[model samples]
Target chain A: MYKKILLATDGSKHSIRSAEHAIYLADSFDSVIELVYVVGGEKSKEDVLHSVDKYEVKREREEKLRPIQEQLENAGLQYNSHLLHGEPGPTIVKFANENAFDLVVVGSRGLNNLQTMILGSVSHKVAKRVSCPVLIVK
Target chain B: MKLQNLKQDWFGNIKGDILSGIVVALALIPEAIAFSIIAGVDPMVGLYASFSIAVIIAFVGGRPGMISGATGAMALLMVTLVADYGLQYLFAATILTGVIQILFGVFKLASVMKFVPRSVMVGFVNALAILIFTSQLQHFEGEGWIMYGLVALTLAIIYILPKFTKAVPSTLVAIIVVTAIAIFGNIGVRTVGDLGELSQQLPVFLIPSIPFNLETLMIIFPYSLALAIVGLLESLLTANIVDDMTDTESNKNKESRGQGIANVVTGFFGGMAGCAMIGQSVINVKSGGRGRLSALVAGTFLMFLIMVLGGVVAQIPMAALAGVMIMVSISTFDWSSLRNLHKLPKTDAAVMLITVITVVATHDLSKGVLAGVLISAIFFAAKISKVKVNEIVALEGKKKVYKVHGQIFFASVNDLLDKFNFNDKVKEVEIDLSNSHLWDDSAIGALDKIEMKFEQNGIKVTYSGLNEESKHLKKRIGGLSKASGH
Candidate 1:
């Protein structure tokens, strides 16, 4: 019954594993996967006024998603890639809820400070906050 | 040093700075007097220091718009000196403190402030808040409910006045109205005049009267060291906060030297030493101050009030000032930290609590921060010590890959070394470090131990996917690991 799937990655090994699980789920459900990598720098007004270099961040995101894209293409999975910008946790939740994604597939735990603060483990925030089912893969 | 920055920093926001300066000047009056009492000096001494420091720092300070004045944190450091060596020696110490601070600036010690952790800063803030609140209690001694009622009234005015208009400072209004009530209502409360007499004259320059000997130098040096450190810490932290608020950069080294010069000048002018006040600086900024003229105006206005309008300022009730300072303590405190204590990691919470308790118990700001940093470091070391090294064997036990995870240092090198049992049926081992980082010589030593142990067992140990830093550190440590060949 799933039409759209959101896959969130932060370039960690765990996130890459989560992308693998997302690709598998998209294949079974016949859903188009939306691969998203958000650059988390806009946490406050000060952060917005002095944001991190978006150009460099976009390039880094593409590099991180390369292997995942190759896997999806090999599996004949239809996917749309997105390099979003904002604080990781709130931004991810907002985007998924607004787009009416059928499922959000994320890592069980994130490695970066912003991601850890946003999700903080155990019945993870994405699983708790998102309207759609959140599959937290290890 | 660009002319554009100089003009923009000083005059681009002249009107705002002047208004902010006036508000800061009003706030400084009662605070200077109270801090002077705490420092065991005449009220005018605090005023002189407040004025001189503000004026000099306005022209030469690193922070363009921050308000520097007589502060309780610096005053706390002075109490012991004044009690032991008397005012002359205290003056000598203040000047010495300034000289030392100037040297610190020259040596680029201001950048060292980054080493101070945010937890320590929060702890310091909370401790100062408690100290300020407790210091105000003595003024309430042997008083009736009427004095308390007046304090409550003053607090109401301060809290409420802001909502109606920002044109006038609520603190100034609160002080004026409360003092007017004290005079007309025949309230049995103490005023500034009750604390000490007013001279209302210009500060006369005087050299500190102390013998230029080792004994004198020894006594004053310790006090001077403490003053210089505390003064710079408070000023630099205040500057940082203001920079964040205004989104601007400041010459921190220049600010340090400027505070030194200000204190030296104020010491020569028969005043106690002072530093930047975060509360007043915030008030100045919020009231439209974004330039040097604001600080200059504050100093001139403080002097004008003391010298020309001494009679009126002297009559201002102590209760009103108490209300204003209590508000300052409230604003100065990190209320969010307290609220988020439960959300914080146990280690961070413990550090913040330890800092507050240590500072409160000892009444020493630096000691509390040190205590917090020490405990935080211990906890941090303990946390990183848990990073494990997982070994995965592949290709029918012929190829074994040891995956190192987390940080490697003196504390956790043993953990890395312990993983090489050498009893496994694997003939070759690849130590994959792409997922981890190498930190020090101890880590390099641990790698060598792993290599030797594997060599003894006829298994080839190879490091794979090492980061640049790890590679550099390994090279520096001189062949900590062997090549891929057997």
Candidate 2:
């Protein structure tokens, strides 16, 4: 029943699969997909103070999203892209709460299951704390 | 790299360290005697070890608060040594044990500390506490209610002394005040002098004349090995504890080597084997000790106290020392964690209980640890063996998906082999690694076997939903083709 689905991408290997899953679900539900990339505050702050070049980072972020944008367009889905400067999990949850997205999908690197359970993964945190149901693609 | 910068930082840290060392020295005086007696060595040898080891470790050790000296773990190990071989042979064994520890550290084997299970550590600490408590109960007997009163008073003083005063160590104050009152009141209590004559000289280096006796060496070797392991474990653990408290890091290998050196020297100097003392280290940290200077000061203070104040200090009652040990034991027992163990997994609880029971009943720390580790490993193996393989045939297409449900290890290799269908009409076998996570060498070997078998049968096996880690399994099996070119 999701009308607008938000997929968080980190450019990690697993995040690509998460994007694919989000696209497939969006197509099945006839929903609009939003691709959001959150550049961590530590990264953005460093870029802003000229500690590192800004255009270099901006170009890298765009290059990461290019394939996923093309996939969404080829699937004929209503897609929009946004970039935010913040921490990953909390930033995603804040975006979801503010935007009224029906679903959120994320990925995990699947280490020790026991350790993951004790110290929750990012997806597990979103699932536990967020008001909406969050899917964790491992 | 700059000399002035280096000097400024070293001196800056040293000022804070020396203050902490004074408090540590005060606490060490009583503990050194008590721990030495527990090891069945003369009380003075304990003092000698504490002095020498502390000074040496101050210069060579990696962690700031890790005060190396005679500890209860080494004391327990020394019991078997003293019982089997006389003091001379025990000394020889301790020296050799030190050499072994040094080799272990030099070989960079300190990382093996991580292999010690959490449950085993909890069991070891709790069991040692019980052992210490029981040992003190012997001294408390036949001395009337005054003995109990003294112990209670000492504990009370130790507890309240810290709250009112920070200038003097609570334990030292408790001992001194209790000893002075006991002597003046002529309280018929057992004193340290009652044990034996206190040696006034520094521990002299002498060759142990055990005469090349293989039988005696064979008997003491096992005990020495246990001592070495316990010494290594306790020292490393104490170093880590101090590191956490002081917000600093220790080069574990360096610390272990320093411990090895301390023990070897202690043995030569007529002292029993020793290790890093967690209680003293914590006391040092709490008392404002900040660097190597404090440890060196403590060592110096201990040597001076033994040589000049030996007669006066020896007049302190054994019951008072027992009381101190009893307090130390209770503090180290981790009763809250023991109670919380019941809330843990049944296997963990079982391992912990087994370790504690074995350690206390057999009085062997190494056996208890070994028992706990073995049980934990078996429990892990059993859990991994429960994973099974399932095959699903999707009706939507002729897609034949083979799901590896359980872990594929040497133990469960046959199950995986038996589940696969090698007959004709099988288009492609999709090995699902989505639910499978853990892999061991045996499991990888099993996968290799399956790959060889499948290749011989002309069956194509493609892995689906393989996570980054489990993909390593495909590499081991020599059967992975990347799903995407990127």
Per-residue lDDT of candidate 2, residues B373-486 (tens digit): 898888887877776677788645455787777676666665666777666365556778788764655566555555555656776666677777777655665423222211
Docking verdict class for candidate 2: incorrect
Fnat, one value per model: 0.00, 0.00
lDDT for every model? 0.81, 0.76
Predicted candidate 1 versus true structure: per-residue lDDT over A1-138, tens digit per residue: 888999887777887888789877888889999988765421221221121223433355578789888878998999998866444666689889999999999887644665554335522657878999888887
**Model 2 / residue B454 / CA error / Å:** 10
**Candidate achieving the largest DockQ:** 1
Candidate 2 RMSD to the correct structure: 15.7
Sorted into a CAPRI-style docking class, model 1 comes out as incorrect
Where does candidate 2 stray beyond 4 Å?
A1-138, B2-10, B213-216, B395-399, B414-430, B433-486
Question: Per-residue alpha-carbon lDDT of model 1 for B106-127, expressed as tens digits?
Answer: 9999987666666777788789
Off by over 4 Å in 1: A1-138, B185-188, B454-460, B475-486
Worst 10 residues of 2 chain B by lDDT: B477-486
TM-score for predicted model 1 compared with the true structure: 0.74
